[model samples]
Structures are given as structure tokens and as C-alpha cells.
Target: MADPDTLAPPRPRRWKRLRGGLSIQSKLLLMLLSVSLVSAVIVGAIGFTNGRQALQDSALDQLISIRELRAAEITETIDSVIRDASLQSRNLSAQTLSQTMNAAFDELQSDPLSEEQLETLETYYAEVFIPPLEESSETEYSDTAFIPDSNAGQRLQLGYTSRNLDLDEDYQELLAREDLGDGTAYSAAAAQYGDYLTHLVEEAGYEDALLLNLDGDVVYSAYKGPDLGTNVNTGPYRDTLFAQAYRDVTATNSVDAVEITDFEAWIPSLNHPTMWVVSPVGDDDGITGVMAFQLSLHRINNVMTGGEQWAEQGLGETGEVYLVGRDDLMRSNSRLLIEHPDTYAERAADGGTSPSIASRIAEIGGAVLLQPVTTRAISEAQAGRAGTMTGLDYLGGDSVIAYAPLHIEGLDWVINARIDTAEAFAPVVEFTRNVLLSLLGILLGVSLLSLVLAQAFTRPIHRLVGAVRQVAAGDLNVQVPGGARDEFGDLGNAFNDMASSLRVKQELIEEQQKENEKLLHTLMPESVANRYKKGDETISEAHENVSVVFAELLGFDDYARGLTAEQETSQLNTLMRGIDEAAAKAGVEKVRTLHGGYLASSGLVIPRVDNVRRSVEFARQAVEVLDRFNAQNGTSITLRAGIDTGTVTSGLVARTSLAYDLWGDAVNLAYRVRSVSGQPGIYVSQTVRDRTQEMVDYVEAGTVETQGQTETVWKVV
Candidate 1:
């Protein structure tokens, strides 16, 4: 038996089998399909990259716009508040209140507070102020340290603040309850100018308004808070920025002086953050007490957050603008904390916040001075620069942020607008997904189309390729099928036309070869023309004795101007033909013809013993031809001719467009003799005169200049 492996019909490898199975049509299909899919993928990748960048830029630009707008709004609002506070301090009502309250407080100084009233004032501080203060500030406080000292101050706090702590009435309601029954001049002053100062807090959105005498005593309060009876310059809150602003204005003591204080944690107002604007309350007496207007945090938060209309303000989901102090702590409320506490806590913890702080932020429902916003944007902005960047947000999530420093006086705050990268780049993700899907669909479609097109085009292409090979091998008679009505049919028709044109061009080329040979012989000597045709790039020969004749038709320009261009050309052609026949008959070879001149030679390419005589005879015949034309056309065109016989060099010039020319003493002397002859006749040089005087008739012609030397010339008759 045969070997088992051999009998199994040699198993083909996978690649070999695949290669054998694929025809030209299959290969073409695969190549086109691969190119189409790769191109699509490349295009899709480029588009995705560009689109992602564009979306990122748009997101950052949007953040920057929000940041700038909110910064302007915050600055303007703060400025307006400062102006209003300064103007209100110098108002007539405020000045009168300050003078009246200071007098009333002086009168009530002797009337000391009862022991029960002192106890109530101390109890209010201990229960209402110190506990929350200590909890929020993380510090210990003694209630007695914060309680007011003078009996007059203690009585006022007991009547307005301590008694009204439970009702939770606004400043207007508390101000309306003016009849405190204190039965003292202090009560009368409180009732008299209290409404105007209360209006500052109620209508103007101030947190509180206080009137302080020059001694820094809190003579009156708008909301009657625990700070009502306190001395700002020398009391429990003496170390606060509020007191510092008071001292600053007091030191200036000018009516135009207005001082600002940065936000701080104050024991009053339940230990919440507060800011102040202090200006002098004055009259014609010059300087008096100062009026302090407490700035409301709600107004700032409303401006920064767009009244919680984040979407309407173009801050998409998870976008917010807030303020940060130089301490890297939040100066405004946190959006996430207000909207979702648990979520905020988780994010805050992830952002490296201690668990206790996160819980406390959730407990208090605020972010001011609690949430940390330490980031590159914050650091740069705090350094007095403004810019936009992408970095980790406070929640430790990748975000785009825009930050700028506020221009308000006495405040070191920066504003930031932020959005998560996930939200900002959502469009890019969607576009990427769509592009990938489109690429997949395009690949499938291209595969099917390539297969169909390859099969249809391969048959005709194979035939055309075979025909081209035959034509390339010198078979121009080959034809391809031209029956189908498609591009292949058109290509086949064009091919047949090309082949027919090639056959016609072959016949024309043979005919043109003969004409070119004839024209070349007419231009130069037959021997020189032959050398040039045989690829001789340089063709030059010296003849020891050659006759050169130069002839020009005088008066031709003026004569031809009267004739039309066609008529002029015809007249010249007729004259040239006659001269050519005459030169051939006279044994002279025509070298070249100019606009109205003719150059010819004898014995340059052919040996001739009588070249001088033949050249002079040719010039005589040329004059006769021009005479015939002038007579027939009613013109006075005449021929001037010169001839010489000597050694000459003849060759082709400007090889790209072959121009046969001869030049030597013989040619130059001939040209000079013809040009200076000054009359229409055949002039010959002395060399020709000596050589051809026996055969040709001559006359005495004056000498002509040749190379700055004079030479005798003869006229052939």
C-alpha cells in the first residue's frame, strides 16, 4: 500500500488554503474593505479627540463666565451696602438718635438694675449664646464674661433681648413693642428714634443695626439680640473684628469715615458668621457716636447661588458658584449640603474631611467657615491671580473650576464656579459611543459594497490589463470588449481609439521623418543635417575656402506696410521660392533666411573650385527675383547682396531649436560689405574679386569696413 500520509492527500495549512481560495476579485474586495474601515476608524478617532477637547473648552468657558458674573454681582452688592450704611449713618434721624440716646443713657446711669434682672441677663447668655458659641467655635466660654456690666445696660437687655428671646419675632415686630415700661429716659429715647434705625435692618436686609455712643456702649439694638447691651470697644466682644472696625472709625472720627470688618464668628446672633459696616453718626457738632450695620449672609448667598436657580443661570446639574476666604474655608453655603446632607457627608469624607466635621456640617446645614476648599484655583486666586483650571474639587472628584479674587475692601475672599468632569464631558461620551457604532455599521456596509464592486470590476479589469500588456509589447492592434454600458465599456472604447491613433501616428511619423530630412538639408549642408539627425549634439566643420553671400531686401518694410499681413507673407514666400531655385541652379547652398535677409554658402559642405563665382551669381539671381516681385506688386523693394570666399566655420547654434549658421572672416566681411554697399546691387569682397574676376563681371565699388579695416568690394554685373 502507498504511505498513509501520502494517500491522505497532503493536508494544506490554513494560510495556504486561504491564499489559494482567494482570487483577484476576493483580494480586491479585502483590500478595499480594509482601506474603507481603517479610514473610517482614523476619521472617527480624530473627530472624537477634537470633539472632546471642544466640549471641555466649552465647559471651562461656561464656568469662567459664571465665575466672573457672580464676582461682579457680589462686589457691587457689597459696595452698595457700604454706601447705604455710610449715608444712613450721617442721616438726620441717625444723628438725632445718637445724641438723644447718649443723653438718655447718661440720665439712666444712676438707676441700677435689680439683682433679678442681672440674673436673667446672665442666664440668657449662659443658655442662649455660650453653649452654641462653644460648640461651633470649639472653645470654652464663661457666661459671666459675656454678661453686660452697668445696671443701665443690664436693664435694657432684660427688657428687649432676654424677655423676647422666646417669641422669635423679626426686628419690625420687636421694634413695634417699644413701650417696655422701663419708666426711664432710656425708654423714651428707644421709642422716639427707634423706628428709623429698625427700618435699616428690616427693609434694607441688614442682619442687625446698632447705635453706639462715643464710649462704645450699645445704646440701642434693632433686633434686641444679646449684643444689644454690650460695649463693642471694651466689653466681652472687644477683641472681635466688629470692635476693631469701631475703634478704626472712632480714631478717624470724621463724618466721611466708613470702616468695614471681615466676617467672623461672633458670640451674639447664636455664634453665626457676621460682617459689619461702621460709619460715624454725626451732626453740626462734628463727631458723635458710630452706627454699625450688620451685613446679611443671605444676600450674598442669593447672589452667588442665583437664588438656587442654578439651571436657569447656565450652571448645569452639579454646578455651583461659591465664595472662599483666605483661610481656605467656605464663605457661602454649600449647595450639596443644603440639597443632600448624607451625600454631602460622604463626599466631604472622601475629600479628606474628618468624620466629625462632616457630621457637624450636616448637623448645622451650612458650609461657611466649615467646609474647606483648599485647591490650586483657591491658592492662585488668594495670591491675587485669577484663572480657570481642571483639578480635584473639594469632594475629591475631578472638576473644572474658575476662580477670581473679590475687589471689596477689608475682605480676602475668592469666588469659584465648579462642575464635575463627568457631567461636563457627558456629551463627549455620547458622541464617542455614536461614532463607534457608526464605524461598525460603515465597516459592514463597505464590506458588502466592496465585494459586489470587486466582482463586477475584476473581469473587465483583467481583460484590459491583458490588452495593455500586449500593447506595451508593441501590439497596437489588440482590442478589448466595448459592449457593456458602464465605465469599463467607456475605457475599452477609449483604448480602441488610442490604438487607432497610434497606428495613424506611426504613418504620420514616417512621413514627417522625410519632411524633416528635407527641411534640415534646406537649412544647412546635407552632411551637417545627417550628423545632427544621427544624435551628433555638436556639428561643426571648417572649409578652407567657402563662399558666403548675404542678401537683404531694401525698402521692404515701407512697401509691406501697405499690404495686409497675409499678402505680405505671400509676396515674401514667392520671392524666397524664386531665389531658392536660383541658388540651387547656381550651385550655392542656402544657410538661413531672416525677416528680409538671406545667407548662403558654397563649398562649405561640398567641394567646389569656383565657389566665389557661384555665390556672386546666386546674389545676382536673388536681386532679379526681388525685381520681379516689386514689378508685379507695384513696389520699389530692392535687394542688397554681398559675397566673399575664404575659410569659414559652419555649425548648428542654439541646439534646442536647431539653427545652422556659418561665421568667419568670410561671413563677417560679406555682411559688412552688403550692409555698407548703400545701393541695390550684388557687392563682392576683394577676395571674391581676385578669385572670380575672370568668371564674373564686376565694377569699382568703394571700400567697406571689415574688423576696423577697409576692404575693397566689387559689384557683380
Candidate 2:
């Protein structure tokens, strides 16, 4: 007898210590996540600042380098032309031009000396010179018509020289011009000058230049002008080239050569902003005529302007750039300046002043208060220094400024680029911001996940606490639920499996009782039958798995119909019994009586006996039995039987009948023999034929297509 007070259980140790819901692990994970989030933001901000600054510096350097490259290209081209010009001045002579021209004209007129020969003349020659050579010069001077020496046709000639022909085609064509109208002397002098000019740049250090007559006509120059009347003005360059420069050049015998600057360098009167030299052609005492040539500056804007386009592409969306002239005005060709030109114009109008740097900057909605830094590239031209700096105070925002001077052909232009520092390094800043924000989100999410996990762990622990009480109360199947994939899930699954196994164990015991009853039944009739048929130990039932041979008597159907029922039955029974005894003598197992002679082999189905090879022998013995019985009874009979030896399972043909049967190939092949019979005495199947090979003879009927096999039949009589 247990005491009632002992049922009061002792309190558990764990519940007293635990709080509830979230555990300590959750709080720790949340703290780690918060710290990570804060750290990420701070580190990202610092990295963005440093990375952006570095990228901006690299970009500015690249821009400056590219501009420098373009400037170098322009300088080199100018230097080549300059060197060529100097060579012409020192080495070219009039004698060279004369000798070359005479040879060229002579070649043009040499074909059969006909006046019509002039048709093939692509060389430059005056109409007057052509007539003399074509009609008279080859005619010995006195024998020609139109008063030979006094004729106007004798005075002119083609312009050609060894050097002019050897130069680039542009120079050769310029020298080859044919018009000697009015100022023939100037024309002649200019052609001789072109010959020397051709080789000058390659030989000396001077640029290509053209010297014009005070009449704005190209006279004696290193690079000859287009032609005498082919509009010799190079459009906007005409004033700087031909107006006063021509006058000043003509005033002095020769001016030491100087540079030809860009459009901005043209200051009308005193020190003409153009960079060039006027060397006058005259006697040594004083100046009479000027021979002018253009100067090559350290930079050329034509090439530098190309750099602006390149920079715009390189900088992408970072900054705006401008190429300002010496007058502090923006070069009008730039897209930023040209399209929004009114902005600067408006500012100057409001201030009642000429367009200047500060005015233009303000007009364009930019700040004028920003400190402007310049490169000391062209102090002589009064332009400022070049470099990169921040655009301070002006826009009231962070900005970077970079600049370079464009000095070429006496024009000193500055290329200034200003970008918002934030804009210039935007790629790095954006990338950092995104990365930081993503990290912060990941951290916050992790903290939230930690809280969730803490709640989950606590829930399982509480369930475990309740389960412990249940287990103390002797409930062995008590369970706890948690979605954890860790060891907890394994424990839960194992508990479920144990409960399932316990339930199944009781069911197995009950099932064993019914199985014992069924096993008794199975071991009775069925097992006994199998043993008898298989020659096994149990001998309770009769069964035989002999080579069954079923033989049927044919023509009994027609013959029996012509007779009385008694006679018919008597004759058929007599025929079957005779075959039965013969089957018995052959040691065959006869299952029962039938309308036909049915006989099964003896060895496998009944008691074991030797000399029973093929079931065909049983079919053969049945035929002999029927033949002799028919002879004794004075009756005619035809028999067909099939034989095959195989496993046979015996069972009742029906429950309420004495007829029993054997199953499997042994019985099946016997039926086949009955189906395939033709004019049967004793017909046996191919299976019977093969099995009887040792004791009987077989004639292999070639394979015939039937019953899933190419088989043949034989009558073993």
C-alpha cells in the first residue's frame, strides 16, 4: 500500500531558473547586429570620402595630360613648316626658277612642233608664251608670222622650278598658276620665291608663311597663295594677313620672321596681336618691301579645341568646361558658350560693361565670388596660370577646378574646367552609400532574426519543461514541438518514432494470433498436395507432377450420333479404360476418367520409376492401348495426345466435385497437341519430341510459325 502523500512530486530545478519567452542568446545576437550596423555606416562614410578624392585627382591628371598631348601635336606641325621656310630663305635663288620653267615649257611643245600640239598641255603657260613656242620659237624666230620679236606672244613663260615640282602637290599647283596679267614682274618674282619656299621647312627652323604685295596680292612668299586672282584671302585671316601687315612689311626691307597667331590675337593698330615677322625686300640701307611669315606658338587652339571635345567625353557628367579668349570672353564655338551665350551677355548689360570673365560667369548662373586660378602659361599675352583647384565660395558648394592655357599662333587662350567635388566623385560616393546601406539593412535584419531565434529556443525549452512533468506522471509518449533543424529536431523525430514503434508492437502481437490460425490452414491441404506432387516429406494428399499426356479419340462424335446412347457410352468407356490400363502399364499417372484417353507420366507425378524419358512414350503407349482395344472390340479409333514434363500444382477442379486437376506446362502442352492434331494416330508436341530424345526417335519438322514459337509437330505412332 503506497502512501497518498508520496504522490505530491518534487519541483523541477530548471523552471525556477528560467524567465520566459526570449533567451540570453537572442539578446547577444541583437547587440552584435546593432554594433555591426553602426560600424558599417561609419566605415563606409570614411571610405567614400577618401576613395572619391583619389578618383577626382586621377581624373584631373588625365584631362590635363590629354590637353597637353593635343598641344604638342600642333606645335610639332608648326615647327616642321617653320623649319622648311628658313631653309628656303637661305638657299633658294632666281636662277633655279628660270632654268626649270624653260625646261617645262620646252617639253610641253616638243611633240611634232604643231600649234595643235598645245591641246595636250596641262602644264602652266601664258597664252603669249604658248603661241611663241608653238608657232615661232621652233621656227627659228625670223620665218614666223605677226612680227616675231615685237610680238606680244614672245614675252611670257610657264612658272616651274625643281623644288616647286618636288614639293607637295598643293604648293606645286600654286606655283603653276598661268595668269601673268598686268603685274608680270610680281608674278615672276613670286614664282621664284615659291621654288625656294618648297624645301625651306625641312631645311630650316621657320613656319610656312605667305608674303603679299601692299595691294593684298600674294607676291614673294615661302608658301604661295592660291593663285593671282583666285580670291587669295583666307576669309577671317585676310585683315591680319593682307591689310596693315602688308603695309608694315613693305615699309621695311625685311622683318625678322615671327609667328602667326589665332583670331583672338588681332589687335588693330600698334603691336598687332598677330605673331609673325615682316621682312621687307629692298636695298640694304632702308626698308622697302616686307616678306612676312607666320609664327608657331607653344600651343595651337585648333588642336586644343579638339581636347575640349575629348575632355567632355572623358569627364562624362562631372563638369562643364570653357575655352576663354585673352579678352576673358568665352570662345563662341563651344556648345556650352554658344547655346547659352545670352546668360553672359545679360550680366554684362546689367553692369553696363564689356563682356569680361566675371560678367560671363555670373550670366551663366555661376558664382563670380569663387577664386579664379590660372596657369602662368602666357604672361606676355597677360593670360593667367593653369592648374586644378576647388571652386570656392562661388556656387557655395564643393567643386573642383582644373585649367590649361592654349597658346598658339600668338593667341593665348585658357581652358578652365570646374566640377562640383561631389559631382566629380559621384560614382565612388554612390557605390559606398549603397554598400553601407545594404550592410546596415543586413545587420538590422540579423538582429531581428536573433530575436526570433531567441523566442523559438525559449518556446521549445518551455515545452520541454511541461513534457518533463508529463513524463514524471508516467506518460511515456509526451512530446515537444520545435522547428529547429539542429539536434532538437532529431530528438523530436526520434521520440515520434519510438511512440509509433510501441503502437505497432501491440498490433504485431494481435496479428500473430490470426497468423497462427492461417498458418495451420496453409500447412494442411495445400502443403500436403504440394509435397505429394513434388515427392516431398508430407504425404497427406495425392498429387503427381508427371509429364501429362492427354489423348482424345476423334470421329467419336459422328460415330456416336449414329448409334444408341447405351452403345455409344459403352464403346467410349471401353476405349478410355483400355488407354487407361496402357497408361498404368507405362507407369503413367492417370488423374481420372474422361470421354477421351487422358494419361499423365509416372516418374514426376506419382511413384518414381525409371525408363520414362519423354511423355510422348506415354502418348505412344496410350495409342497402342487404344489400337489393340479397338481391334479386340472390332472398333476403329483415332488418337491425339500431347506430352510435356514440368511443375504441376494440384487442387480440386471444384469444391463440390471429385474432379481434381494439375496445372502448368505439363497440362497446357497436352491441350496444344489436341488443338494442333491433323489425321491423328498419336500426335505429340515439340516439347514431347525434345524430351523423348534418349528413348525414342524424332524427325525434326522444320520450325513452323505458331504459339509464339517457330515449332513443328510429329506423329509418334
Candidate 3:
């Protein structure tokens, strides 16, 4: 160690020393590199986040658009079918068909048919009616004959039984057969009317059409099938959708109102899904019968599948639009399953679908009338919620789905448009990857550029730092080099200009200090002004013994009203100036002046022993000054002065207005005394009279009432 009195300079840490030893160029380069890296990362992250959100929103919009388009198509198709069925139900030809059958049934029920008529009717049923039924039922024929289990199968079985084509002879005999006498005329009318209905069905693209009586008996069929003469209400097919729909339509109060039934499998028509639009038909009576039109599922599928090329309608790959009933079962065929059954099945299996759903997929090979959709989108839509969401699809895959309820009558179904999330967000992923790579490249290039810039700026920056240090040490005369005409040179010029401006401003500031001091003294007492100028917020002092003088011009208001505004202002100013001079001469501080009143105080700012005497003298002088003013201005504006001596507080009232004011009982009493009527001279309070009895002349003025108190006042003359 060296001598005990000598101390060595403390050494910095290794890292601190290293940092201190680094050149300006190295430090600047490091700082720029860090900032650039952080900025690049921040910008890239923000861009990626925004881009992803934008893409997701776009996908949701597209899904909603697709859902709306498909829903409109379905709604239009249903409306068209209903209108056609309604028109046909009310047609004259359909009425004729019903009447012809009704007349033939009435004839057979009222009277027995002759042998010749029975033979003719049998021949007609065999040749004209039985042939078509047999032809339409060709699909039901199989070498291995079997009993049917489905509603469609039961309907076929019931038709065969009613026709006596497949049932036992005893059962056929038990069924009452209608005997139409003189069948030649009835057969011709029936054939012509049946042909007309067949034409209507063919032209309308309907699978079949039937006319039923109020008893739910199919009296006429366009295809002349075995369904004829079968009572739907009590027949073997009573539980079918058609029978249920007929009962519903006939039960309605309005016969003109059309009713549609939900889609269900119709067995007589090849076990295919079918929907019916039924309208009640009536003559002069009420609803006597109902006409049912079978809507072909093929036509409906064509409308719902977007005319066979749904992909062209904005439903991208792995995207489809389908309908779901309130029961969570699919109402329409799924495009994916219809187009790629094997792949759909495999995906369904891999997705761990329910056993019932998987079995239905395997059996039906598609979603039509089979697949159950229990996804959140369908559930919410059926529950009356209409929006888009990201959730698990029917196949357990992540999907973005948009769903809405279809406003179709007699059908509680929701339409959903969906796509795989992976496909929908593919662009977002690719964009994010590209942005990150670009940011990395940009950061790399920025680091190299920052090094070059740091080196270029170091020389100028070192000169600037040295100049700043000198200026900070009060060496404003130091000049920075500005040889190169770049930003650095401009900065040097600005620094020199600023230094010169500061030196000149310093000189002006000193000169302004004296002027401010003079202005402050005029606004307040000397001590209060000094305290305020020294940055004291409140400049208030209490004086134990002080005198307050309040002087008001009597008859000033009446005199001001008679004079012009400018003349009145001039006269008031003259009177105030006189009062101010009088107060100054009497060694009292002029506290404040109002429109017609003036206040002065003594001993508050600078304590004095004869403060009461001084205040009384000031009041007397102010009254004399007003008297002189009245004489010079050719007016009679006398002065009413009040003087009081007591302990009072005085201070600057406000900083902006610079109103110096005196407060306390002495000031209040002085103000009240000055406002006394019938007294023109100076009035002195008891306290003032007591303090200045020897110095001032006072005459007893009878007790005056002021502020609810009676006080004996003395007039100074």
C-alpha cells in the first residue's frame, strides 16, 4: 500500500471497463444492431398476426356466403314445388278426376252392377290399370320374395293386398269391392282423366301423384298403381309419411292452404326419400278430398347440390354445404360422400364416428337421410343461433362452419357450409413463414449496414459530444467543425446558432428581472412582492396592530349616469388618482380600488406605532382630494370615508389580477362605515377613535346601524 493519506482510483468491473474502452463506432453499431433486430421481430410478429386474422375472417365470410347461396337455392326449389302442386290441386282436370271417381263409387254403392258391366270393369282394370301398376312395381320384383320392413316396403305390401294380386282369396273376398254398373262410360272417363294426371306428373317432374278422398282412400293414382283403392287412414300403410300428411292436410280449417310433409323414404317408389305437398280439394261442399304430389328426391338433390358442380360455387376443396334436420340427421346428401364414398368412409372411420353414423355411411354410401350431424354449428343453428364458428365437424376434424336456419314451412332444418381449418388457414401459414424468413434476411442485412453507418457517424459524433461538454461547462464560445455539408454539418450550425441565441437571451433575462421587480412592487407591498418573486405561492402576513381606510365617492353613480361613458370613466380615473396620491402622501399603502370605492391600509406591510393616526389622516386627505376633484370637474361628488384600526390580515388576493386585499373585522367595519348614508365626511370606528383621538379631530356622529349592529361613530373633519 502507498501512504495512508493517499488513495488510489477505484477500478471498474471487467465488463464495465470493456464497455468503457469500446470505441464510439463499436458502441453505436451494437446499439443499432439491437434496435434493428427488435424492430424487425416486432414488425414481423404484428404482420403475421394481422394477416392470420384477416385470412380467418375472409374464410368465415366465404363460408357464410356459400351457406346463404345454398339456402336460397333450397328455399326456391321448395317454393316452386309448392306452387306447382297448389296449382295442379286446384286445376279443373284434377277436379274432374275426383268427380269421375266419386260418381263411379256412388253408383256401385247405391246399386249392384250387371254381369256385363262387371266383366267390362274387370277387363279395363286388367288392361289399363293393372298393367301400369305392374310396370311401376317392377323394381320390387325379385326371385327371392321377401316381406318388407321399411315404410315403403309396407306400403308396397298394402298395395298388393288391396289389389288382390298377392293376398289370399278369403282376404280379398272380405274386402268390399266397388261394382260400377254400366262401366263402359265410366271406364272411358277414368282413362282420359288418368292420362291427363299422368301427363301433369311427367311435365312437373313429380315421381307420382295421387287423389285421395276424405277417408284417406287413394281413389286415383297417376301411375295407376296398386295404391289405388287403399284407405291410407286404416290401411296397412297408415303409419307412412303420406298417410300422416293427408290427415294433417284434411284436418286444417282452410282447404286452400297447401301443406308439405317432411321428407321420408317412400317404399312403393323404390325406397327413395320423398316429400309431399298436399292441398285439400272441395266442390260446393267443404274439403271433400286431398291431392298429394310426390316431390322427386333426384330433382331436390340437383337443386341442393348446386347443379352437380358445387365446387364452382366457392366451396373449395374439402368444403361442402349440406342441410341438417332438427333431429340432427342429414336432410341432404353430402357432397364429399357422394363424390368420394370410399375416401369419406375411411375418413369417417379414422375420425372415430359413432357406430350408428358409421353403419349408416357404410349402408347408404352417402349422407342423404342417413348421416347424423351433432356438431356445434348444427346444434346452435337448430337452436335459433345464426353465425360462424370454429369447432369439431361431424367427422371430428377441425372445421370452420357457418350455419343458419332455413325458413321453410313444415321443415325445421339448418343449412351449414363448412371447410377443413387446415385448408382454410393454409395461406396464413404460408404467409407467416415467408414473413419470418424475410424478416431474418432483412435483419441480417441491417446488421451489416448498421456497422458501416456506425463507423461513418463516429468522427462527427465525437466532435459533437466534445462541443456539448464544453458548452455544458459554460464555454458557449466553443465552435464545432462543419466542413462536410451533411446532417452533421447542419447540426453543428444549429448548435452554434443556439449558443449565440442563448447568450443574447441571458442578457435580456437580467434586464427583464429589474422590470419585473418594479411591476411586482406596484401590484403588492414591497415584502409581499419580494416573497412572490422568490417563488412563494402565498404572500400573506398578519399584523397585530393595523389601520384600514375605505373611501367611496358619494353621488358618483348619479353623476356617472348624466355624463357620457368616456367622460364618466375619465372623471372616475381622476378622482382615483387624487385618492392614490393622498394615500401615498399619508404614508399608507393603497390596497385595492373598485368601481366607486378605494381601500388603503397602514402598518400591515410595514408596522408603525401611529398606524391609526396615519389611517385617519389618509381618510381626511382622501375626502379633501375628492372635494378638490368635484370642484375642478364642476361636479358635487363628495367622499364617504371609514377608518378602523385593529389586528388584520393582508395578502395578494390573486396572482393573475394582482389584487392586494386586507381582511378581518377592522376591514369589514371600515367598509360598512364608508357605506353609511347621511354622512359625507370621514367616519372613524371606535377602535380608530381610540387609537387616533389625540392626533385627529373627531365629531360625535350618533350611533349608526350597520350589519345588524349599532355602533357609535365619530366623523373626522
Q: Pick the candidate with the highest TM-score.
A: 1
Error of 1 at 619 (Å): 99
Ranking by TM-score: 1, 3, 2
Q: Score residue 364 of candidate 1 by CA lDDT.
A: 80
Candidate 1 residue lDDT tens string, 1-717: 878876654323422333334455555566567667788788878877888789778878888888899999999999998899889988888888999988887786787777786787778778876676687778898878766776667777778777765534655677676657768888877887788887777789888899898888998888787787788877888999999899998888788888888778777776788889999999546777989999988888899899999888887888999999989999998888877887888889999888788888888888888899888999999999988888898888898888888888888899889988788778878888987888788778877777676654444387789998998998888887553334555567778889889978887998999898888876777788788878998889888989999888889889888889998898888888999999999998888888898889998767898887788788877778777877888889888888888889988898888888888998888888886659888888888888877887789788887778889877777
Count: clashes, candidate 2:
43
- Which residue pairs collide in model 3, if any? 152-267
Give each model's whole-structure lDDT: 0.82, 0.48, 0.72
Off by over 4 Å in 3: 1-24, 105-187, 283-285, 455-717
Better of 1 and 2 by TM-score: 1
**On a 0 to 100 scale, what is the lDDT of residue 352 in model 1?**
84
lDDT by residue for model 2 (210-322), tens: 44433343333344322221112432235554345555445444434433334323311112123454444333343322344555332233443454454455545434544
Q: Which model, 2 or 3, shows the larger lDDT?
A: 3
Off by over 4 Å in 1: 1-19, 114-116, 127-140, 165-171, 283-285, 440-717
Across 390-421, the per-residue lDDT of candidate 3 in tens digits comes to: 89888789998999999998888899888899
C-alpha lDDT of residue 520 in model 1: 81
